[model samples]
Target: MTNPPSLLLVLSTCLHLLQWILDKLRITRLAQRILLHVLAAGPIPQHVAIVMDGNRRYARGKGKMVQEGHGDGYMALRRVLEICLRLNIQCVSVYAFAIDNFKRSPDEVDALMHLAENKLLELCSHGNLLQEYGVRLNVVGRLSLFPENVQVAVRKAEQLTKSNNRSILNVCMPYSSRDEMTTAVEGCIREALAEDDYFTESITEDTINSHLMSVQRGSPPVDILIRTSGVKRLSDFMLWQCCENTQLHFSKTYWPDFGLFDFVPIILEWQRSVWFRRHDVLFRS
Candidate 1:
């Protein structure tokens, strides 16, 4: 037999459970309709770029291997992509892997390469996802550096999504803003020489921009650059393209813990901020 005098304790426990259930139900409903009708009628951002950080830290904190963190981050990326699809964001760029990461320990590098290769394959092979979203896939990087299989998958994904127009998703693998800038400079030099024999010796910022990875590919300038894991720096991301007015949204949550639920709030906040800025500009103009 149980003690009958614990009436207050029973009531408190019951109330806590009821509150938790209500909160869960509320969040679920809210997620199903985060934007509702208002956002559907307003202007949405055309481009969003994200720097995914803190995978290793998350794994360490959870007493798991670092590679697991990458897997978690991959899941988070998928979630964000889905959110972008629903939100009608025209373009999204994710910093998948940096060239500097190649200098990591051999074992870790191998694991990461494997993960990236698998992810690329999945993106290419997931017919349902591709067909449903109509997302165009683009991978910006030194493709020669990737494994042969990864190269094949990247090409396949690009081909599969070539005609789609719902959104453009850019995955940056073994990529860096500085490297892109250098490449752009070289391209500008080559292009300018073709037009006139008396071409100048060097490239200006505007010329270089015309040759940039996104510019040549026809991507809008990044309206928002989100950095996860509480990091304050860009880590060589979009150094040339991200201008003075480009907004930054830094979240404390690890990439793996990030999902559509996390994306909605950031996007809403970004919309508000962009509106305010545009209003200010209009008034000043």
Candidate 2:
């Protein structure tokens, strides 16, 4: 005959069960508001980045088409953005499409382009959700590669959201850190060469930083980066920006399955880290 589960075991089981429920049905808005109040009492990161991965895996796991997974991933972005707006996060960057994504099958790439165009246009319809939230949108990447019609939508979204000042959302499309860095370096070189008396001292870290895509997009350095789908790597993402003073959170849940409950706990952990760091508490202990 076995005894009843220990208190710790029972508590752990309950927490796990709660997480299962939260994954399916998110905690009510009132609970989210309480979490936000707690977050507001602590030091909040100025900038956040997310490497949204595993959309296709999520779709496959749910017995849906890969494109449907991407569609759901976009919906997840909307949810996260709403949370960010409520939290007053200053800047948020998301990996929308990487440069390497062009290597996907022609049909898939075309589908993505269509989806992007539709979404951008949708943002302009109705009362303009982004405008109402005062969230500025910046689409950063190699823009010339996009088809003409898609480019029109991109410009429209940026224009529509330009008047907002409350927060910034940067969507990186067909982007690669290597390409961004190379472009910045090239820009610096061209400027230095253009000036007859250019000195090596003038090309400082600040100058190069000013030329970075993030800077041009008006995003500060990343304070915290969260990657979903349980992946650990940055995958040629904002490498230089994330190199220093960035807290990395890797979630086991796929991007589509990830929700606010999964996010707030990670951020609470970040808040704790920030508190300890400010107090000079050695992490080793």
Candidate 3:
């Protein structure tokens, strides 16, 4: 009879298999890196806005509490912020809390406010990623709608990071696109009256755009808008800032589940569209 394989032979066979698996993994990773670099070669978007949605749904699906869902969503936001920094995106605006969200149950609203206050404090802390990445934080919504303490925390965060120049993070709290447009109109009228004691020049798109909350923070119009939870509608977020060419991406993944890998495909698609558009223009010319 053939002798049973020696212990040394079995051990060697296992080692060989392990080595092959490790090599395959390394090759796969290198291929992914190459693809990512190729997708990133085109014009990077200067500003990106995201509507972080479905925190409650995600929590319920996982048999967790709403607060836990919100907490997870916060962690996702932190990760996405880091990813934006890595991508060299100059500005990011998130639909954190809309004005209409006040219609939620009182306890839920209170929990959200508490979460926001704690996060603002954390963002303003010394040597946090906001500081490390030189990110300026701005609360781009009506401050009076929030609790006085929340307002104070937001102002403190904004003041602490105002000097940073590497990037801007705009948190939309108690914000509505209609309300924002109304506020911009009022601001334009007030400025015109202050300058000439009357409306001299006709109101133009630039007049309203210049007075917008995002514009005041020196952020350009949104280049791409990604909404989670499979939401395709704008939902009153950044109406004026999403220009005609703004690439809109909707991901079925809930906000709490979103990660860098979910975002990479969106960027790749946007880059492909940009390339096609440029080629079309060349053909027309």
Candidate 4:
């Protein structure tokens, strides 16, 4: 009681705290509405692709190891998968490890490999919740480079959920869009030669796309590509397919900090944009 803050100081402090509380409440309400509407309207994405970024930066910010950030990212992904199921999303693709990531320090690369190995093993033993939801698991990208054990686990998970049709979850490991395109070209060349067609003449955009690694069984084109960590670059993920009016949602938050609730607002924003784009023909007038 001997000393009191100036009136201006006290008012400013109270105002700041009040504003913080209001912001938190508003965000909470928005998240709740987003979830409810997503479930009720079911305007879910046919295909959703994600670029998980910022693990190292997040770790640095928290004074933690990069490995810990990656571990946290893995757990966050599990939560998002559940959200995808609840939203009735038909296909979800996650960019796990890119071919360019191999350029990182040996210790970091080792940590990533270890994480993949452990996750694969766990998926093999426990299985995904996809079955109960009729979701199928698919692994895309260059799998020949993975360790023998990891490959086996990947194949096992794919086989276990091969017949399910509720949704498709595609995990891209060691993926490169250019490499994927080249591989598709190779496949087309083989198919053309098999039919006695000229390999040189048979390669076309459509031919190559037909052979690219994707949902062989009615996989929908990606409608939205979400990248975390404020990174504007696509990093060679779905490079050829995303050029035409595909919506992009960027988050400053690191991948590890993302959760089911965080995605709700993003989805809502995407939907609103889509609606406007679709009706722009009339609305612009």
Candidate 5:
């Protein structure tokens, strides 16, 4: 029902808005460069786990639709991924969707699935930033439960980046710590039964680690776990991997509002911890 002139105007407005956003994002590039230089002086985390929460709440607070908030959250994720890639983080794991998240309203869940599929397809295409960075894509979870189209998209993404070896991006879609652990345990039992001495000789923590979805896909043990929207609990994400050695970070800011500034402090804390440990050892020796 729209006329040609009006449509052109709308398109122009959108283009201008997008350009403005791009400019604003670049405004932080210089700062990011300086920050990365500072970070290079210390050890960077090999594996960083993020529990992205509060999209619906962000939408409610801003009078926007839930899906809009999620879209913004996706944008935030892209920025964080860029930072991780720039910092040369070995493994970046994000909890995009949990198995229990299926309990959300059907409309919201459908929206999320569609959004995820579209974003994934876009990211998998050649010449994207992820491709440029040589970041391998691993969607780690119970993927069989997804819709056929979504599964296809996920497969395409994984196939597209399977050759990338520089860094890893683990999208924990519809994953559950409990389910992962149970599956690993079951697999171990099966293997033990198949091989008489396997249970007695081979089954150990490392064996179980080899069976976990993310760990098997190539992510290392989580060095830092962050939950946004001020959440303090692990919320069933990476429970086995986020052990005593892992630093836990809970930010008061909403996920969509979290940015480079918010994340830098957490990394700094981890770096400080590393330095302190090294200094204490040297002093004792």
Candidate 6:
């Protein structure tokens, strides 16, 4: 006859199973608690921007289709957005697609456009995550450049979330830094021409900044710019907003592989850099 398992052994096995369940379900909450504690100790970036790079490369490495990689990147984006909401970050901007990307093959560009349209529509759907989090969505780019259907979807998403004040999510698609600057300049010139004192109202930094895409939504300049996939370059992302004071974090992990835990060290590093800058310790004569 087989002996029954001891009570202590059974209790230990049950405890381990319970721990595994909590780890799978509440891991994000644990990370949020740690991040909150860190925020209490130091300053948190008011505006965080991401140059979500390496989706295609990540997919290729895994022997998957490029579109599949983009899908994974979208999933990673969703997770990061949740983290931002939990951390109470005021604004978060993502480089979804750029104007130069239109030069790609027709099929690829079409796929990307379709993806954007679907995502925008999903955000505008009833009881979407944006509504739950009170996050206002802003699509900043030349809307006319996109397909009519995409334009309509983008407008719908923006309009639906326009009143939410908990946070701002900026999605830059078909966007170019150079074009944004030119547009700002043109807007400033138009404003100057409208005024009686055209010569007196010179185009200044503030004038250009006021006309920038994000300014219309009242988003502040980006304080931290993170790029995944080991890329160090900005790739024409948020050139004006990520000013001299913005801290840059380059991660080796691909965007699809980025997770909530990945952000903890980045925030800690930002705090360290801010502390050094404030104390005038990092600069050398």
Error of 3 at 41 (Å): 3.9
lDDT (Cα, tens digit) per residue for candidate 1, span 8-90? 34544544454454336545645455543335455577889999999999999999999999998988888788777777888
- The pairs that clash in candidate 2 are none
**Residues 72-156, model 5: lDDT tens digits:** 9998999888887777789999999999989999999999999989999888787997899999999988999899989999999
Q: How many pairs collide in each candidate, listed in order?
A: 0, 0, 0, 0, 0, 0
Candidate 1 has its poorest 10 consecutive residues by lDDT at 2-11
Q: For candidate 6, give the lDDT.
A: 0.82
Give lDDT tens digits, candidate 4, residues 1-285. 422235334544544454454346645656654645544373556788899998889999999999999999888788788777777788888999998888989999888988987885555344457766787777888889877877887888778777887788888888988888888888888898899998476687777777888735456678889999989989899887674867888888899988754576666656555554545554566
- In Å, residue 128's CA in model 6 sits off its true spot by 2.6
Across 1-285, the per-residue lDDT of candidate 6 in tens digits comes to 422335334534544454454346645566566746655455678899999999999999999999999989988998898777777789999999999999999988988988999988787678977998999999988888999999989988889998999999999888988888899999999888888547755988998999998877778989999999998999988999987889889999999999865676676567656655654542342
**Per-prediction TM-score:** 0.84, 0.87, 0.85, 0.82, 0.88, 0.84
Model 1 clashing residue pairs (backbone): none
Q: lDDT tens string, model 2, 1-285?
A: 432235335544544564465567656789877767756666778888999999999999999998999999988988888777777789999999998999999988998999999998776565866777888888888988898988999998988888788888888987998999889988998999999647888788888889998788788898999999988999888888885779999999899877788787666666656655644544344
The C-alpha RMSD in Å for every predicted model, in order, reads 10.9, 6.6, 11.6, 10.2, 13.7, 11.0
Model 2 — TM-score against the truth?
0.87
> Which whole-number lDDT from 0 to 100 does residue 6 have in model 6?
50
Give the per-residue Cα lDDT of candidate 5 at 24. Answer: 62
| Stretches of model 5 off by over 4 angstroms after superposition | 1-27, 197-202
The per-model lDDT (C-alpha) reads 0.77, 0.82, 0.85, 0.76, 0.85, 0.82
Q: What is the lDDT of residue 185 in candidate 5?
A: 79
Candidate 6: segments with Cα more than 4 A from true spot: 1-41, 278-285
lDDT of 6 at 28: 58
How do the residues 1-285 of candidate 3 rate in per-residue lDDT, one tens digit apiece?
432335335544544454454335534555555644644555678999999998999999999999999999999999888777767789999999999999999999999999999999997799898999999998999889999999989989999998999999999888998999999999888887777757456567999998898889988989999999987899999989999999889899999999756776566556556656765676688
Judging by lDDT, tell me the better candidate of 1 and 6.
Answer: 6
